[model samples]
Target: MNAFDSVVVEVADIEAAACFYSAVLGSDSPHVCLRASQDPTSGFRGFALSLVVSQPGNADAVIDAAVDAGGRVVKSASKSLWGYGGVVQAPDGTVVKVATSAKKDTVPVSRDVGELVLLLGVEDVKASKEFYAGRGLSVGKSYGSKYVEFAADPGHIKLALYKRRALAKDVGVSEEGTGSHRLVLSGAAGPFRDPDGFVWEASASAPLTATA
Candidate 1:
């Protein structure tokens, strides 16, 4: 079965974004370096986000499949502004990005960023939970029967289903007008909500020790 691999966030500043993710996910700062485009031996260079996937070679192919499956390519695969490999946007309007290295041994190792969690605002939490459960996800935790969290991988809550109104209230928003706000979480593993009504969370594979 096709399982989750990684979630990408498109930020205006790559450095800032990396910093924010590192702090929020409780992971070490991302490795910073310049990519050598002129060197044939040196493949494309740019910012890189290390994520876990069963098939590393299929990273590009999986993205292609996502596009074919109805996901839009918001940002085509290319050298990102942050100096890493990346792809943005999937069929559901969710953005997914990736980075790679030319030197097999030098490829950045991804820490166990806990579990990549996604908060999906649905009309009905129960139905959403049921739908995902039928699709191979296991129900993990629930809160007051209002919100439900699902696990796609061990140590990671893949998705969190919540009611739109309830979410707004949790953030102290009235929800009278267009629910628009960005919630940023800082730590090894935490969750945040974007202005587009999508919730995103990331966690490092392991606890952080130091920062650079």
Candidate 2:
């Protein structure tokens, strides 16, 4: 099945952005990275996604495809100050960074890969629905009375427009500092921020176990 992959963040520069991410997550530089080429006529091509570590057994091939697709290299593959290592950029504007351990093993750490589904606050639910529908994303069944799920990918969702206050209460968190909390869900999980700035995540994984 077509699964949800990584979330794409449009940045002005791949190297600078990678540095910021490494600092924020306290991880090493991205092992696999890509930079977009300067070609307006290149049609649907610009920027790159870098992976700090290799992915499964498809590292070399994936890097080649990214370069062939018009992505430029910002930083060649190298080790970082941290023990783990990564590549900088490819062609498209997306920057990807993975951990060194995963790269050496050439296996994905998570069983399921996921994407970040942004829940934008809209003035009207019906109006928002129509806007996304026009973009070719299918709206799916509603979850209870508050949420209306919209198909993001083939089997995943992007936006779950709902009443702002109600969603905040459901998630058991205040809208303040919503973005600060990193909610890691199971594979292919969709996490979103509500209209009122409330954050919520949906996953099909088992509950978290308490640590001593």
Candidate 3:
């Protein structure tokens, strides 16, 4: 089965980004890599990292921690078709969605975000789907021409693709920008960039875990 590994973010200040993400994630993560970018500008990153928790209430606490860690609330916690979640902008400009489903898990609750998923917005959903399919990512549930989700292992970050403008509106951002998307995916055949400029790096390093 195809699976998502991890994401790399380019930030102006690696230390600041690390501090903020560590707080939201509960433990300092080896998952989030902070690279120094010669041109760091905050904008709608065109991608969102989702934190799926076992309990709905956990999402609220995460939002609070994210704000305290220098993240800005893009949207407050609320029930959505997908589940209960809200959007926040990490100090480095990465959009994060904290959500929970009705389903329950026995996993011990922690002060950190759980089950990270990488959501990317692409210009053409079908083309993007074809691109990844060629690269070995298997498709799960999908809405023709609108959205496509990939199957992933338990606790691994799941990958999904949605229409650029619609995704931007979902998390409240303008679907416009340039340069690197600042996302890297490990365990792929090799490093590749999506049509919209999202970078995925294939690394042999140990996969990123939801909690430390």
Candidate 4:
């Protein structure tokens, strides 16, 4: 299986993004990395990052931190049938969401994130699933044409796919986006671009192994 190490979100200003993420996600957080890019991108970047925590209070805590650190709330934290979650657009145009299946807090709320999900809003979920399958990522879960999730190694970022329009609606944004996706996934997969125009570069810390 292709183990994705992290995602590098291209931002216009590294300094500002650094501060924003530091305040929002703190330093040395797993899976999300940042790089400086002045790529002319606008509207939805066709992707979003989800921080899955332990409780509803944890979701609120992260959402508050994100807003305080210059992020704008797209959808305020709320309870849904699936879970309690909210959406916020990061300072660099990346969609950040905090969610948990647990409705109530079992323990004190902290900034601890249980999992980070990378959701790509693609044109075709099945095609995207096949595209990633070709890159050695196996399917973890699938909901027909509606959604798909790929398995990840322990300590790796979880990847999922949803329809572009639906994802935008879920995050409370317009699906019509142009220019760069402004997102890159670096892992043992080396360099390749997916069918939906997501870039994949090799991770320096975890380079792709040559097949025998």
Query: Which candidate achieves the best TM-score against the true structure?
Result: 4
Q: Rate the local accuracy (lDDT) of all candidates.
A: 0.40, 0.36, 0.75, 0.84
Q: Per-residue lDDT for 1-212 in model 2, tens only?
A: 11233233333355554444333222321121222223232221111122333333333433344454444444344434543432323232333332233334445442122332433333456665665455444677565445566665543324456554543332222323222222122223345543332333333322111111
Residue 32 CA error for candidate 2 (Å)?
A: 15
Ranking, TM-score, top scorer first: 4, 3, 1, 2
Query: Model 2, 181: alpha-carbon shift in Å?
Result: 16
- Indicate whether candidate 1 or candidate 3 has the larger TM-score: 3
TM-score for each candidate, following the candidate numbering: 0.38, 0.30, 0.86, 0.94
Show the colliding residue pairs in model 4: none
Better of 1 and 4 by lDDT: 4
Per-residue alpha-carbon lDDT of candidate 1 for residues 1-212, written as tens digits (9 for 90 to 100): 22333444333334444433443233442321111111121211111122323233334544455455544544454433433333544221223444343213233444223234455455677766665566555777877448887655544325566676664443233334332222222322235443334433443322322222
Model 2 lowest lDDT segment of ten: 41-50
Of models 1 and 4, which has the larger TM-score?
Answer: 4
